[model samples]
Target: MKILLVLDNLSSSCGANVGIVYELARTWVERGHEVYCLTRKDRFHDIDQQKAGLLHMVWSFDVTEDDILNNVTKSDKWIHLSATGKAIFELTHPVFLQKMIDKKFCESSEIRNEYRKQIEKLFKERSFDAAVAVTEPFYIADALASAKVDTDKYVIMMDPYTNNPSTTDRTRKKKLAREQHVFESARKVFTLDFVGNDMNYLSEELLGKRVNFCVPKVKKCGAGRSDDGATVVDSEKIDFVYVGQLYEDIRNPELMLKIFTRLPDNYILHFYGGGCEQIVDKYKEILGDRLVIHGWVSSDESALAQQNAHILINMNNSIKNMLPSKLIEYINTGKPILNICQIQDCPSIPYIQKYPMAVNIMPMDNDNNIVTAMISDRDLETMAMEVQAFTENYQGKIVEHDVIENIYSDCISENVADMMLEEMQK
Candidate 1:
């Protein structure tokens, strides 16, 4: 069976879309099925294309800053001749929308039309047994619809459209229309987390569509070096680490800075990844020698950094269900988990809290209480043991491979159905 995976920016490691595509495709390839990645040509699009061992095709479209700002209207009156052209221009080109909210440009008709045109052209040459459309937004769904794919299509829903508080008014309308199309048109819907049920409610209210939920597999890092040859700092001189975007809204790295700064001189904090560099720089100025901001470590190096750290920190203010894909890699490393974000009601949160090595922190004084629960020596010892146990369990876990293999098996089973249906005509 051939499976087609479609996404806008398919190369991003930080984004959920690429993570799902890579994990699913890796599993599909291992199971001996052909996998194709269809995405728009963009900055990060080429990064993992070859690594995935999947066919890569890009829709011919380039969105520049000039196209985003609706500046075309200022230069040429012809673009405003019809509402469709204006709306299409505004939706596909997102320079203006970013000014409103740091949002993606997949809402535009121009982008959708390009996706549709390219996909249709590809379909004329190659047919797929099944397709998985990830991150249901307006333009992607519209493109799928324009390509006229049938009801057996599957779409992985991340968060519903309304949950994005930063959505622009124009984007909101376009999102509503496209989301409706996805729910009504796609054969099935799979959500990474439990948020899809909420999305289904919104979908039924807006588009009269029903959605299904499936737990997406958590990802593990490519194996890292054992700490054998690495210099093991004395227990008192251990380092803690935090990786990924650090900003005020989702991850308050500032708060982490305050807590780690107050720690005795023996402790160190290594910061990796990009975004809010100034914020991190401010901490480096204050914490000086205690804090090291490495800024954007390579994938392999970052995994090594996680292994070297005495403790690895993962925190986010997004809804509890908003699991950072990196957390899975963090878990696989078997380091002590210091989770700053906690929700008692979320399904996954309970498992994390149950881990004897996990420290679930909540605000004790104000909105973000810098003071976290005490990390006693006994707790650290227990955590170290848990880390060892976790690493062993995750080391080449057949279950992770199994989940993906099952999804591929499900995809290939359709080939059997196709054969059965053809035989029935006999």
Candidate 2:
């Protein structure tokens, strides 16, 4: 079997998107199938050659230097209208330049045309059994949908549309339209969450049909230690570790900071991602030695931190249906989880509640008052007690790793690949 994987960005390490793509490619190769990947050249240039070799071919696309220079120096004076004349140029020039800048000098029209040309060339060059395209940057998915290929195409919808909040009305409308187009055009759509027997209303509303939702498999990182044989946590203090992006609105770091300040001196807070620099600086004096902020660490270091921490924290205050990729690694540790959510009925709540070692904290009320209430001395004290109790009870306890693992084994890339192959064959 021959498979083609399309992604906008592929990092060297095991990031959320990269990990899924890499694992699928590796699985296909190990199963004696050929694989090809198409992605941006500049971003994925440094991928490990040996690991990349598993794929039969990796095609990268980028704007050439000549194209950049030509677009920069080219004048738009010739593009004039009879009625508006120079006024049209004044209004449209800025918009054109912005589009060029926003698209990294490869204009949308050029990208679509070039990508179509490339896809056509590839179709003529070789045959493919199936293709999988990620639905971010929707244009790539649009391009793949329109390609003149004979294979069945699948769109991997990692995050549902309901979870994405737009800044403006126009942006929201555009996103919705693009999502609708991609979902409707694909042969089959797959999501990373196991939405279970209950249908995902948003997905059905968008696609006009039910889609496949698969849980993600968790890979076990060796027993909670780094290569140097040193533990990832401090033995004296109770370490609370968080490892992922800290968006101000969605995954607020402010609430975490407020909670950390009110906690007891024995507790230490560690942040291991970008976007919390401003918050860290603001609370530096108050936090003093209790806060350890490592701006961004490699994927391996992230796994090490997850394994060593006494407790793992996830703050999803805004998004309801989406699950953070870091949660999988956190659960793999068999340690207790402190999941802070804005809504009581978040999709993750049921799953987290089922895990004996995990605790789900939802706001008492449904409004912003929850933030104010959560930071109160009384509320903070209660939370701290809960954490203490959970840690004491679950410490050194052995969880049924296989039983937990069984829940997600079907969602692994190998299984997903097999499903795709079967679907294509049918």
Candidate 3:
């Protein structure tokens, strides 16, 4: 069985799209399926390095940075854009800059052609049984879909590219024809979150093409439990660690900022991710060293931090359809998780509710009074106490048993491998 996966990074800590596909690809390899990958040169992970010799073949797209300090910003590897195009990107809000940077990269012909050639080369080497194209960068999917490979091609959209509310109408118009081709080229399409799955009608309406997007429940992670001694675990303190980007208006850290101060001084909150500039001082001023801010970390470093933390924190976007990518890593940690939902039906609730050591704090609910927004002092205090109680009482970790074992094998990856074997048998 031969399967080809297209994504940004194979690193679990890179984000959701990569992590989900990595677990799926890993399982297929362990089952003796031949798996190949095309990813960003800089975004490759060490986990795959250990498995590279016999397990798989990886063709990284190209270097996105001189060094990884470019990190999520992508400022170093950016080329081909006109001077004005680059200047306009500088003015984009820091919260949204990383995303726009990605869009800009996807707009590059040079990068796209390089990926197309590699995709063609791989297909030329052997006809793949299945081609799974994942997207945060929609162009990669476009490249994969546009390929002349005879395999059953599929597209996994971790984000709603044409329908993203943050994007302007002009951008959507520019991308619609291109993305419709990608979706139409695939045998099936998948979205990571169910909310997005429900919005397939919206995508179809926008694309002017038939589209059926299903949510694949591949949330289990096989990586990210390694403790490299990178984090200094304080046995005397209770630490609630949050990893991922922060937004000023959208994914604001106001709730996390308020909650930990209510706990005893021994309870601390550590933040790890980008877009921390606006609140770094505020974190110091309000919590005064109790809420530690770790601005940016490598994928390996991010894993170690989560492995060492007493509690993991996750926040859902208000869009309702967009789920946080960090939830996968948080679940993998097996640590008690404190998930703050910004809306009533936050997409992460279903997954969080299933975990034995997880709790959800939403904006409003009859059963829970957990919103940090303009609630009375009493409600705020009660919420704070509830967090402490939940944190202290959980003794069990979320182990491998919590995952749906047959999901990948019974669904996409396994189906791909089996169909190929069936064809060979014929």
Candidate 4:
């Protein structure tokens, strides 16, 4: 099958959405299917095409940051209007109305009109067996609608609609409304979380479309295991590593600093990836030489850090049903993990809770409780064994080629008749 995947951007090693796209596209090509990934260009100009191991063609649409914010509401000040517009601009760029709205100031109709024209042009240029849209609010709605995709096209929405707490209510509602409009016409919608956890509230509440939950496969790294469950990181110093963005959502650097401050003089804590500016600055002062911030390393670097650390820490304000994709990398490292989050049944929590090497702590737990657990000693070998077993089990489940074949094939079969009729009638 020939598939066209549309996403926000494929530049960063930021989240699971891009990771899943990379894995899926690469696997499809390896299986001899023609895969074309359509995405926007980021600061890293060649990022989309440079995603290695994926034997697929990538096309970066020429849409500027200014294009997205041109006519958006001033009242919606809380949301990143420019960022939100950029997400949709790629697919709607060529349309004159959208162009006018993008370059000048026009009403929503003019913007959407131009957007529809560009979408139609995209459809005219290439015929895809399926179209997979990664999640956001309604990032793909106009594109999908304009594509006039025959029902056989797949619409995979990675996020539950209106779920970002940081977004403004107006933007969230608009995104949700767009999602519902698309859902009513789509054959199926996909999400990364368990069934009940996606952003398709209207699909369930009104349209009665129960979402298809697809578990994302972490990239296959031949991570080894130890029989006695003991592995050593031959480092000059004992290191505790936290691999996540410096963002408020996950890093929680302030809390991390407070927790690690109680540790002995020899132990060091390292930060990788980006996040909170103030917190990073404050930690630099107190920890002095003890804290190291590597700010945005490659996946290989992150993996190396995992292997080198005595313990890997994942701090989140809440976990709920969502699993931080980074947890999968930690699993691959076969190292002990210390998870700090609020939810009990988070995707990572259950797996980690069962393992001897994992210590899952909630925010409600006082500082002393966490400090005591961290200071306490345990059979490192036994813990390593548990981590090894968990990783092996997960890796065993992912058959890359098979997953791609099945998902795309299903996309083709599921909507053929409906899509054909819709397209032909038009």
The 0-to-1 C-alpha lDDT of every candidate, in the order given, reads: 0.55, 0.63, 0.64, 0.53
CA lDDT, candidate 3, residue 280 = 56
Better of 1 and 2 by TM-score: 2
Q: If scored against the real structure, what TM-score would every candidate get?
A: 0.69, 0.79, 0.73, 0.68
Q: Count the backbone clashes (under 3 Å) in each candidate.
A: 3, 0, 0, 11
Screening candidate 1 with a backbone cut-off below 3 angstroms (N, C-alpha, C), the clashing residue pairs are 68-95, 91-108, 92-108
Top of the candidates by lDDT:
3
Instruction: Pick the winner on lDDT between candidates 1 and 3.
Output: 3
lDDT assessment of candidate 2: 0.63
Q: Residues 19-138, candidate 1, lDDT per residue (tens digit)? A: 645655665665566767677654433445455445544333454532444345434463225667766656775766453233345445566677777777777878887666666454
Output the better candidate (3/4) by lDDT.
Answer: 3
What would the per-residue lDDT of candidate 2 be over residues 1-426, giving only the tens digit for each residue? 787787755556535766666766676687788888776544324456765677888776774532543443333333222436644544667855555465643326556556666766778888887777875545677778778788777777666542355325546555556556666667776665543233233465554433555544454333332233223345568888898887656666776677677677878888898664566678777898898888778877887787677788877646555667666656655667888776555666655765667877653444533454345566666656666676666543434555556665654456776665566556
State residue 344's C-alpha deviation in candidate 3, in Å.
Answer: 1.2
If both were scored by TM-score, which would come out higher, candidate 3 or candidate 4? 3
Across 1-426, the per-residue lDDT of candidate 4 in tens digits comes to: 676666656665436666655665655665566766666553443363467326456665554442444333222331334656755654565554454554333224443444445545666877777666655424554456555645354455554445654446656666666666766666555555442464445644534443444344433323131223344443455666888865555335565565556555556778887657566778789888899988778777776777667777776544344455566556545566667654445456544553345665544433422332343333223333443354333321222333333433322222332332233233
Root-mean-square deviation of every model: 9.5, 7.6, 6.7, 9.9
User: In model 1, what lDDT does residue 72 have?
Assistant: 51
Model 4, global lDDT:
0.53
Candidate 3 Cα lDDT to native: 0.64
User: Model 3: clashing residue pairs?
Assistant: none
